[model samples]
Target: MSIRKRLSPEESRTAALEAARALLIETGPQSVTLKAVAGRIGRTHANLLHHFGSASGLQKALAKDLASSICAKIADAVIASRSGIGTPRDVVDLTFDAFDKEGAGALASWMLLSGNEDALDPIVDAIHDLVVELNEFGSEHLRDSTLALTLMALGDALLGGPLSASLELPRTAARDRAEAMLLGSIDQAGTLAPEG
Candidate 1:
């Protein structure tokens, strides 16, 4: 029989995360499993356990990975947008794009359906970081507006069809409407709707 190769602890953990991320991107978060990720990377379920403790651990790790990457992209976009190199909306667009194109939407939907409270922690932290970064860049004025747009974008990424139906807009145009709504609110002086 042929022998399998071995990996260091760091390499194994990284491989597990990569496998989980690929499974998430390809088949959505519902399909991710420690066994599946371990199998995908030619490792064992025990290896996953050693690295991640359990499936919940793996899911939390995966969620953190996705959220961190999305936040990093947002951070990069902010850096790129300095000196009016990009519009303020670019950050919103990038955030939405990350949620849509980078599997954050699927992760969010999965976490919500699974009632995974731990998963949301990373996303909330990332958003907080983004808000701080925006404020630091002199866009403190955009805080409320930015948070609203981010909610819309993230909500749309998962529920665009329903939102479109509710608004009588095409599925593809929900984002455009969201952007317009944000722009309209940009000139308004207020806090976030005074949460009830």
Candidate 2:
């Protein structure tokens, strides 16, 4: 009888990572474990060690993946707007939506496991890059990018809060409020503009 060869180290880690992400999204991050991740990917505990030196290592990789994915989505949403019509509001909405239960669970894990602000540095840099890409503001609008990031973070925090447990009505209401506030700010700024 021919014996089936086991997956290589890289393949095992890749599978484990993918499975961890899926489980994190579907069930919750608490569902993740060496045994569970291995089983989900049809591998054994020994196989997981080949990829991640330890549970902490796996957690670090997962945190990195979550940060990358979240920042990418936020960046795309920011860059997609050309109308400038409530763009900040759109960003607020999209950012909060990105923090759905799955994302929230992952974020919770990041806070508990990593808990280091340095771990969030990459994500902050990514948002800064996103701002530079989406904005064409001169010296006068210098503060706009900063403002946008702050407000967007606030919105993300709110939506990630326990008060935002429901995904449907609460999210819609928050988006609507954000849209109104953003539009109001834009309109007020336009009124204060000096005539050409």
Candidate 3:
């Protein structure tokens, strides 16, 4: 005696992806299955399969979505930092939070371990595109800084808590180091810039 609400295909897909992301953040990457997403969205497994082709397809779509969303925010933060409206720590926190609180790190590692190595393409491509787009900022060390920041964020997401505890350091030790590195890179870049 229940009526199902009708949704367009795009709406359905978006809903499924949102549900999958929620599952990723709430439960972990291992819980982001087609069935679970479908259930979360009140759709059938066949519906999700139709939209995504398979579980791997769903994961790839989710990864692409997460990358696009996170990169856009990071890009905004980078722009703010360049305009002196934000600090390097803002960028560092966003990057680290994307990996940790947003579940990108866990999802990426799970995809790799599950043999869906190509699922990482979206993440890599997004980072590459972000760097390229931001290259107009004119920092020769931007790429290096990005690499260091991303690796540090990912590593911290994976082990910073336990490692920091074991080392008797604050939980934010890695984030602090990342902020320092970014600030140093910016200073060095400024010093090397040609005089106007």
Best by lDDT: 3
- The sequence of per-residue lDDT tens digits that candidate 2 reaches over residues 109-189 is 354665534444544565566556655543234246345544544455544345455553563565566656656655665
TM-scores for the candidates: 0.81, 0.63, 0.97
Candidate 2 global TM-score: 0.63
lDDT of each: 0.75, 0.59, 0.94
Q: Clashing residue pairs in candidate 2, if any?
A: none
Ten contiguous residues with the weakest lDDT in model 3:
134-143
**Alpha-carbon shift of residue 49 in model 2 (angstroms):** 2.8
List RMSD in Å for every model shown. Answer: 5.1, 5.2, 1.1
- Candidate 1, residues 36-135, lDDT tens digits: the string is 9988998888878988887878888887887788778777766666565765467668877777777777787787778776777877787887778666
> What clash pairs does model 3 have?
none
Candidate 2 wrong stretches, greater than 4 Å? 1-10, 83-90, 104-106, 109-125, 132-171, 180-196
Which whole-number lDDT from 0 to 100 does residue 83 have in model 2? 49
